[model samples]
Target chain A: MNIAILGFGTIGSGVYEIVNQIQAEELKDCKVTKILDLPQNKDKLDIIVCDINDITEDESIDLVVETMGGIHPAYEFIQNCLQHKKHVVTANKAVVAAHMSDFLKSAKENGVQFRFEASTGGGIPWLASIQKAKRIDEISSFYGIFNGTTNYILDSMNTLNEEFETALKKAQQLGYAEANPSADIDGYDVQNKVTISAALAFDSKIDMKDFPCFSMANITYEDIQYLKSHHQMIKYIGQAIKKENMYEAFVMPMVFASNSLEANIPSNFNIVTLNGNTIGELKFYGQGAGKLPTANAIVEDILDIKNQISYGKVSLDKKLSYCNTLLKEKYLIRTNCPIENEWIDSVECKGANYYITTKAISTKDFMKLVNSISDQKAMIAKYM
Target chain B: MNIAILGFGTIGSGVYEIVNQIQAEELKDCKVTKILDLPQNKDKLDIIVCDINDITEDESIDLVVETMGGIHPAYEFIQNCLQHKKHVVTANKAVVAAHMSDFLKSAKENGVQFRFEASTGGGIPWLASIQKAKRIDEISSFYGIFNGTTNYILDSMNTLNEEFETALKKAQQLGYAEANPSADIDGYDVQNKVTISAALAFDSKIDMKDFPCFSMANITYEDIQYLKSHHQMIKYIGQAIKKENMYEAFVMPMVFASNSLEANIPSNFNIVTLNGNTIGELKFYGQGAGKLPTANAIVEDILDIKNQISYGKVSLDKKLSYCNTLLKEKYLIRTNCPIENEWIDSVECKGANYYITTKAISTKDFMKLVNSISDQKAMIAKYM
Candidate 1:
């Protein structure tokens, strides 16, 4: 089986290492037939470097992996790979959450596998669990601390009683945070993650263009101290709860004490819980992301695909249809603002720290409300 | 895709409930075609009932489930079904752990799936994790609280200070135990589970027939108090650790103290920790057994098969294979009887608590030691 490495950076190099380390089975027939680098991206020199464009359309490359972050040629490269009937494996959440519907549709049409287990919790196999959970019965609710960078920062702040910025610096030093950590710090990373998890859990596609992705960006040190006084520790939590027939996906700063199961999820580790009608609750805890763990998922996909091909069966499931509908939730919010459910109608800001429930509002509706709040130059709002 | 269920008992009823409740595109075409029951078993009106013999040979049943407890015709029937190229899914651990090598080989030879997910940890999906772990790399160690009944008994004993007998009786009253407590208390159940886990983790078969499990069957209240003095709360722990080319597997009463993570595992909940070289220490926690959770695994297998079928693929995997080879392990013996290992030239025992970490010993040798001690009417012998 021939596989291609696309966007040979940190993830690409990790995948190469993973393939190199396959010792159990004889891989005499297996090879990384091609390497797709940024051409000038000299950080990756070990592999057989080729233009990223060549392998996307190469007939010999059976699998193509996208590791280069952001929404550039990565999208085009992955789409083209799928078009060429190559199975596409990616760790890029930005591409998956945004173009999942389109990509899944195209991949299914073209008979190619589209997998992104690393997109959500990098190291842990949370995506497969969702698929596995749904097999028994419908997944009613799903929630977790999906993002590790923010978790590390929050953990550091709580542990050392350090300011947020100092904790953020410590996180960056530990490599859990990017230098420009807006996505992780402000909840965009978690938003993208919950979008993917919501899709997998509900069998629906949830794009970033929906919902007010509640973040800890605006959380003050005073709030943390206040939470401590209430026997709580603040955490950036990502949740996707199925209420009624739809769903609500968000990341919020909640206060759970250090001893609470959720709060105990320490630095750079992820603990995810899933529930089906039949299977109560199952929680998976592990190193959510790292060079080794992320590569592990990619390798698993490789083995899964390889085994499928060996068994003379390969089918791409790209329908992108599932519990994609938005979630309406009763908000237990706290804020300093003169507001009502009507002004922030989608998510009503009620009494100081409370908010009215979004009476059957969708994610798109809430996104608009949040954008409107942002437009007013107010500290917008965060939902519970 | 059509399937039939046998034994309309606790797990069988769960299989029925989930088959009726599931509503997904991947499962729409899949159906439970028939239900098989014992000759004297009652429920006749609500579903199609067929004799187990006919169901086993019938060409119509693509998959057969065995919820029937004990060996007897259960093994013979399942074996016949696999020979007929019919996939078999069972919640029966007694059958699998005893003849996993035989059944797995037959299934592989005949191109059928013989799944027993419910056999271990109810619905925590340990087997799939094991399969993935095996494919990824060599599993270094596994620590599991696999038996929920014993766990409940231990937890009850800790919290209530009830005697072992009282706690066992209370567990029985709470539906945590079957009428026959020996299956759980005598350690055969955990021995069977750890045997399977050992095989899965070590890439080799472990003979339980050799070791003949010994547990805390005669533990006294004073022993519990003694454990507390040692700063440890006792629980039946199933562990398998690999050393170089060999592995050690056992079910024993270990001193899990308050400071340890395993101590946090409360009640009938199960937590299995795997220290993979790459993934560090990963822990999977959930309800080990219940009507819904056990049913959850059967439902998961059904969905897994259904998804494959819905995509025009075979449900039974041909890639994964069971290890049926012999291996060696160093056993640490702890017993009341002073069976000094120095009496045997090859075996060296230290004090009454024999630290028989002699050169790697075969399973047969380990069992000989157990039986020799048991022959002297030794109360308990724990192997580390």
Candidate 2:
């Protein structure tokens, strides 16, 4: 089978190495015919082509791999490839989360496969497993540490007792976090991942714009200390709880017991848990992002396509309403301003910040409380 | 598709309920044509039949589910079904581990699929994930807590400070253990599971009788306390490390740090970790065995077969040699007959028993040492 790789970046290079260098049996017959990248990368490889038409116009290219992350040209290129009756495998979470429905429809109409196993949990094979489970069991809920960059930073702060800036720098030095780390620390990365996962786990079209996500930047050293004193650790989690016909999806920092699996997940590793009606709760853990890990997932999709494995049409019957108001949960609020409410429990002082553990309140009420107390540099972390 | 049930026990009944009452889309067309059981169960259900010929003679029965869990008539029945070009799904790990190669050959010759997702790791979707990963990357090694009953017993002994007998009784009371607990406590259960997993993960046929396993019954309360003082916890693990073309498979008590994922798995929960060439370390955790969880996995296999998902013929290229002499590991040995050894770091007395932590040595030498001191009732647990 002839293939083309779009974007000669880290993941693309890794995929090329696996397909060409590793030469595993599953990919032995696959040959990379073209690699589309910037003209400057042409001198570095013999197969590099600057024009996207070189790939899409070539009818011999049976498949295309898109490691080029972004919503613009990558989506356009993949759409063109699918329209030309070529299967596409991608590691681009942004594109998958944004235009999954359109891509699925195009693939079906063109008689091609559109698979993005690397979009959610990297090499963990999470999304594919959830898809398999969904065939027989109803997944009621799933939540996990989706982003590895923020997890590394949080773990560094917890273990090394370093401030957020120092931990973030350490993560950057280790190449776990990017220079422009807002996508991870600000929760946009996790939002995209959870949206993509929800689409497959719930068999619905989940739009990222409709989901609400809270960043990990709100967690302070004082808040960590407060949680430590209470024998808890803060973990950024993307939770999706299914109810009736609608689902509640959000990304936030939740407190897990010190001895819990979520608390002890070391460094940049990811752990995801899916709750099925008959299967109970199933958890998967692995490196969420890296060159080889993400490449391995993309290769898995390529092999599945080569073996004629394809997923059935998703239901899209259930609506994914990003509402968290119906469920009541206890909250730990840390702020400088004095908060007065009957639901608030006793307050404690750690350094200059005051911490209060509130009684169970609807998530809608908690978000409203946070918005109202924004003047005090307040942060709310829910209990897991 | 018409289906036949080989056994109407716990797992069999659960599968019936899922196919009948739940009525998921994947199983909507499946009709339970006949249920084979004793004549005593005939009054409870009109489909119950004591004769095996009733199922094998029925040409309309396209699929057969075997939850009988033993090697006797269950194996013969499944063999007959495959011979008749009927697909078979089983939850019997013992049968899968013992006669996997035979079943695979039979299925291939008859143009039928033999699926056993429920055979290992219960509803965690472990075997299926490993199969998916094997397509893209070579698995180097894997180890995990495979048995829920023994884990529950060990957890009870650690947290509640209960004796072995008390924990055994508690496990039996909760229905996690059988009245004849010898199979589970003797480590044969885990040995069977790991053998099956090794066959799939490495694409090699592994025999359970050739693999060495140490039971939890050998671990005493005093041994647990000694390990606890060293900031470690004992977990019954089925570990398989790959080297060259040979793999060393064993089920034994391995000590892990208290904060490790394997150690933090509480009660009847199960966790397995696999190290792949490109994916690094991947972990899976969930309920290893339960009526619903096991049933759910069986249903998953049924759906996959219905959708024509077939596994490639596994390559048994590598030889599975039972040799542990070359692999070095630290062992915690408890004995009264130990006088001197260069590998022993130090000896400490806990109550009337003497404990020693040995430096790294080949597993072969450690087992030899244990065998020489058999008169002293010695126990050895390796460090993870």
Candidate 3:
């Protein structure tokens, strides 16, 4: 099985190394024949190719592994590979979340497989697990700490008593967070992940825009202290639920009890859970993202394609209506100007901020309330 | 695909219900055609059969699901089914731990597949996850609370300040523990589970006798309180490590910090972990033993077989020596017997008991020391 790795960056190179390191009998014939990367950045690799056509046009390349972490060309290259009758496996959440339906259609039309196990929970086998469970059970809901960078920041702030900025700086220093970490801190990373996961779990195509997201960017030390005083800890959570005929998907910084599994998840680790009708709740925990970990997941997908391990077809055939207003929960709001609302159950004026606890309110209403507030520094967290 | 179920018990009935509930396209042809059980136990189900040959000789049955939960007839029935060219799926850990290698050989010789995803961590997809990871990475170690009954007892004792007997009674009342309770409390249940998991994780056949087990039956409230004072909690842990040329597997009550994931696992939930060379640590948590959950796992295997989704072959071909002496850890011991050893780090005498904390000691040495003590009430726990 000849393989081509797109983007010889951290994850792509890691996949090449793991493909070489595989000692399993069934995967012995697997080999990386081509690597698509910038010519100057190719380093010492002889297999490096600067053109996507070098991979897609090669009839001998049985599979293409996309590790390029973006939407545009990765999606186009994947589609091209599928059109050329080559199976495609990827770790790019952005590409998967944006164009999964189109990729699935292309793969089906070309009679190939398109797998992205590393897209949602990196290295956790979460997406594959959901696919496995879906074979016999209906997945009603799934939610988790989806982003490693945001989890690291929140965990450090809670455990080490570091300020939000201090933890964010540390995360950036460790490479867990990038220089411009808006995609992670502002919930877009988790938004992309939850969108992909929800599509698989509920068997329905979920528009990323339909999944409302609340940023953990503005969370402060005072907010953490208040939550801790109430015996709660905050974690950036991405959740999706299958209601009667509707699906609710969102990402937010939610409160969990101190002893809950979500609260105890330390550092950059992620814990994603799926609620299966018959199997009950199953939680998968591991390194959500890393070079070797993410690469390991991609390798698993590659082997599955090589060995003809049918994950069946990628189907988002369910037609559940996307609705965000059906789910309701109390939220903690910290702001300088909260004005007034019927949902405000209690308000505590502390220093320059008014810490208000709202009654059970739908996510849509809460988003509207937050937007209506004039205070730009206002922060909100779901009390789960 | 016509299916035969051995033993019309909790798991068997659950499997029957789930098989009928499956809405997937590929599994729509599956039907439970026969059930092997005692004559008097067959109630309202016309598919129930009294004799094993009724299933074995019937060529219409394409698969057999064994949920008999024991070592004797269940093993024999599975062997017969495989020999008759029918795929076998089971939820019996005892039989799998005792005869997995033989079953694998039988299935291979008969050109059938034998899968037991529910054998180890009931409904957790633990073995399946290990197999998935093993495809690309070498699994180095695996450990966790494999027995849900013991976890419930320990968790209740810690959180609710319940006595050992009280917790055990509650577990029994809730059907988590058997009337005998020895399999769960004496560590045999975990011993069997670890043996099965270690075999898959390391690709080596391990004897149940090689995996030493320390009973949690003798643990008292005092032991829990003492550990609590040190900010530690007790959990019955089963661990297996792949050494240079040997494997070390054991089951014992171990101490973890209160904030650890192992400590926060409440009620009857089980959390099992596997450390792969590339993927690092992956933890699977869920209902370790329940009718619906375990049955759901069995149905997954059924679907895999129905869809012709090959999990590759189960090969216990690796030849590794089993040694229990290499791993070392501190131990907390409570006993009335006089103990004098170089490994004793500290001794605090409470009312009628000497609470001894040992230095880093091999499991072999610790077991020998505990055996030498005549006090039948002696309790030991590993500090990790």
Candidate 4:
């Protein structure tokens, strides 16, 4: 089958190499017919085509792989490919987070498959593995450390006892984080991933704009030290727990006991755990983001399509509203300005700043209180 | 579909409970038609049948569930069911380890599927996950902490600073260990699991008798403390690493740095890691053994069959010769009588016993050296 790759960048080139190098039956006889890239970037590669129409207009191209990560053209290109009766696989989390339902509907209508295994949790096969179990087991909830860049920075900070700035610079130097690292450090990357995961896991569309994401930018060495002193390790987590009949999805810093798996997740490795009612907590751990790892996940989707495995039933039938106020939880809050509040049941003054661990309170209410407190050094983390 | 269950014990009854409790579409119309058991064991369960012919002769029985744990009758029973053109799903590791190739051959000849997800890693869905990746990636090797009973005992011994016998007694009290704990304590259980995993992961039959298995019974508090002093933690590991053209499969104690993931695996949790060529290290972790967890895995297999997801092509095409002489590795050995050996590069006399850590040596040669020094009191562990 002839396949075209959009954006011959890191992940795109990796996919091309794997399809050419791997002798497995799933990838055998498969050829990359065209690689859509910028005209100025095109060089010795004969398959590189600047025009997107070269791929969408080609009738021989049975599949299109999109590695160009953005919502605009990637979404349009993927939608066009699905409409043109060509199967589509993508590693773009933004497009998937925003337009998954539309893509699924278009693919189903056009008698094609739409797979985005690489979109979330990079190489971890998070969505596809969960989908397999979803065929029989009802997933209650899932939580994950989805962003590799942020995780890398956090791990560096803890391991080297360096502050957040040093760690971020190191991650940037290592190509783990972009120069403008707001997407990762500000928690938007993790938000997009968890939103996509929530959509598939709960069979609902969680709008990216609607989901509240808490950033790790404010996470300080003092906070980490305080957590360490309390025998807890801080991790930026994306959790989607079903309470009553609604789903509560959020991205925030949560502290787990020192011995817990979440606390011990080292370096940039990603761990997404689905709590299935029958299957228990099944975890998928691996390199969450990398060129070849993400490319490998994309290939898995291609093989799934090749083997005539129908994209398991997914729908935006229920628009799940993000609700974090369902259950009460213990929280660790550090603020320099907080002098009085009913939520602050207990407070320990570690120097000038107060380290307060509140009683079990709804996350929404507590976060609201946290948001209201405006100080240079105010930070909040949950004790889950 | 009418299903017959052989051996209505812990896992069998748990399977029955799940099939009855879960209202999944795949198990909707499925009914337990007959349950085979010993004459004296037959009681209030109305579906119990004394004669094996009751299940084998029933043409309406479309599937058979085997939870009978043994090599003799369970293996024969599964082969007979396959010959009768009935799909079989088993939780019996002994049977699967011994006759996996034969069962697969029989299933292929009779146009039936043989699945034993419960046999290897209890509830982790390990083999199924690996098979999914094997479709697209070439896996090189895998290692796992497979047996929960032994893990529980080891964890207890380490955490509570208890002796081996005390930990064993506690494991027994918790129903994790059997009265005849030889299978688990002797490392035979891990051997059986790794053998089955090797057959699937490598597409070759790994005979239990051919593989070398080192038991946990020889491990003492002193051994644990000695390893701890060196910033290492001891774990019983079943490893199958491929080198050149052969596979080296063994069950033994291995030491990892204190901060490594293997060292942090707490309680009875199981971790199985597979190294794929492109995907890097993928890990599956969950409750590896329990009545309900094992039963849940069986139900997963049943659903796979119902969905017609062919048990991904597995072949005992080549009988893998176990050879541990492929690569050289570091080892820590404690012996009552060991003074002269060229391989021993470092020695520390902890007490009356000599703690000798050897330089890199092939596993086969190292084990041979260990065997020679044994007054049945020598303990050896690999440093990985």
Highest lDDT: give the candidate number. 3
**Which sections of candidate 4 miss by over 4 Å?**
B41-43, B336-338
Badly placed stretches (over 4 Å) of model 1 are: A26-28, A38-50, A157-166, A217-233, A257-260, A309-384, B38-43, B46-51, B154-167, B209-235, B254-261, B303-384
What are the per-residue Cα lDDT tens digits for candidate 2 across A1-384?
A: 898999988999998888888857777899888999998778998999999888989999999999999999988999999999999999999999899999989998999999999999998888877877777778889999999999998888888888888999988999988898899998989999999899888888887777567778878776777788888899999988778677788888899998799999999999999998888999999999999999999888888788876545655667666666757888888888878877787788876677888889977777777777854457778889
Q: Please list the C-alpha lDDT of all candidates, in the order they appear.
A: 0.69, 0.86, 0.89, 0.84
Better of 2 and 4 by DockQ: 2
Q: For candidate 4, what is the recovered fraction of reference interface contacts?
A: 0.65
Which of candidates 1 and 2 is the stronger one according to TM-score? Answer: 2
Give the alpha carbon lDDT tens digit for every residue of B1-384 in model 1. Answer: 777888787888777767765675555666777787755654563555666666766687798888887887789888988998998888888887888878888987998777777888788888768767666666788877888998888777776788888988988999989898888887888887887777766666677764435676666554565556656566677877776655556677665544354665678888888878666767788888888899878767766654442111212232232221244554444445556564232323433433233345566675666677753423332323
TM-score (C-alpha, index-matched) for candidate 1: 0.78
True-contact fraction in model 1 equals 0.60
Best by DockQ: 2
lDDT (C-alpha) at residue B350 in model 3: 78
Model 1 DockQ (Cα-based) = 0.34
- The candidates' DockQ values read 0.34, 0.80, 0.76, 0.66
Docking quality level of the chain pair in candidate 3: medium
Comparing to the true complex, what docking class would candidate 1 get?
A: acceptable
Q: Write the per-residue lDDT of candidate 1 for residues A91-129, one digit (tens) a residue.
A: 999888888877887788898888888888887878877
What are the root-mean-square deviations of the candidates from the true structure over C-alphas? 7.5, 1.7, 1.6, 1.9
Which prediction has more favorable DockQ, 1 or 4?
4
TM-score result, candidate 4: 0.96
TM-score of 2: 0.97
Which stretches in model 3 have alpha-carbon errors above 4 Å?
A349-351
* Colliding pairs, model 1: A123-A288, A202-A323, A203-A322, A204-A322, A204-A323, A247-A327, A248-A327, A333-A353, A334-A353, A341-A348
- Please provide, for model 4 over A1-384, each residue's C-alpha lDDT reduced to its tens digit, 9 standing for 90 to 100: 888999988999999998877888667878888999998978849889998888889999999999999888888889999999999999999888888889999999999989999999998878877787776677889998898888888888787898999999999999999999999978888888988888888878787676567778888988888888988888999988775558777788888887677777888899889998767888878999998899999988887777766425776686566676776888787888755777777888887788888888987778678777788567777787
